[model samples]
Target: GDRVLATAILDRVLHHAITINIRGHSYRLKEKLKAGLVRLEETATTT
Candidate 1:
């Protein structure tokens, strides 16, 4: 439930950010968000 909820929230946030703009700052943020998401998924699967 937590994983699903977190992913849904992250998707919504990323979608909103993308709609605003897809420039340098957002690009960097998107990368960081993606990395964090990957780690989250890995941790969830491992545990």
Candidate 2:
């Protein structure tokens, strides 16, 4: 009974959800790249 209620609530919540896809370089990582603190290869591996 508890699981059914929880699932119903989750379904209602996700019904109105919107997915956003941000396309761009991160500001912090861009600065780090400029400062030579983080390498491009490092970001590729970490993310």
Candidate 3:
């Protein structure tokens, strides 16, 4: 997308909207972690 057009579209859509900034990993990764399929570097090192 053109930067100018993208900015215009974003400006229009967000004119009356409230935005939230979410932090950290996504739910899918969390699920994988809980299921013992995904591990953080520290966890993998320990095990």
Candidate 4:
């Protein structure tokens, strides 16, 4: 359930970015960085 929801949200955001060209957007950049950090933390904790 969680993976499916995350995948859906990621896909939607990617589609929106491609269609609306959300490059150089501070909000999106911050969000991406935050998500990356979260993934890194998760991986670190797992290993």
Candidate 5:
């Protein structure tokens, strides 16, 4: 009953789930750099 319904919902969610692994610069920082709000040298030294 409840357990069966929960299992069905979880199964459907897992079926549509896709794992993502992201590795890159921050999009916000990139935008800032493009807008001249952030400096390339500052990011290089901070990280």
Candidate 6:
């Protein structure tokens, strides 16, 4: 993956951006989780 090349692009994209943290289960994955089919671990997002 061209992560290094994309870093500059991402920096510009996030500049002056207002981010909101939305915590809670995703309704889209509700059925999957209930069926024991989805991942339960929480992974940190890349900056």
Q: In terms of lDDT, which candidate is stronger, 2 or 4?
A: 2
- Structural similarity to truth (TM-score) of each candidate: 0.34, 0.56, 0.58, 0.34, 0.45, 0.51
Expressed as tens digits, the lDDT of each residue in 1-47 for candidate 5 is 99999999989988979867777678998999999998998998775
Q: How far off is residue 20 in model 6, in Å?
A: 1.3
Query: Model 1, residue 14: what's the lDDT?
Result: 88
State the C-alpha lDDT per candidate.
Answer: 0.62, 0.90, 0.81, 0.64, 0.87, 0.70
| Model 1 regions lying over 4 Å from their true place | 18-47
Best by TM-score: 3
Worst 10 residues of 2 by lDDT: 16-25
Regarding TM-score, does 4 or 6 come out ahead? 6
5, model 4: CA deviation in Å? 0.1
Per-residue lDDT tens digits for candidate 4, residues 1-47, read 99999999999878857456544436654576677744544444443
Off by over 4 Å in 4: 16-47
lDDT string, candidate 3, 1-47, tens digits: 69999999999999999999997777877788889886876455544
Candidate 5 deviant stretches above 4 angstroms: 1-21
Candidate 4 Cα lDDT to native: 0.64
- Candidate 4 TM-score, true structure as reference: 0.34
Predicted structure with the largest lDDT when compared to the true one: 2
The TM-score that candidate 2 achieves is 0.56
TM-score of 6: 0.51
Predictions ranked by lDDT, top down? 2, 5, 3, 6, 4, 1
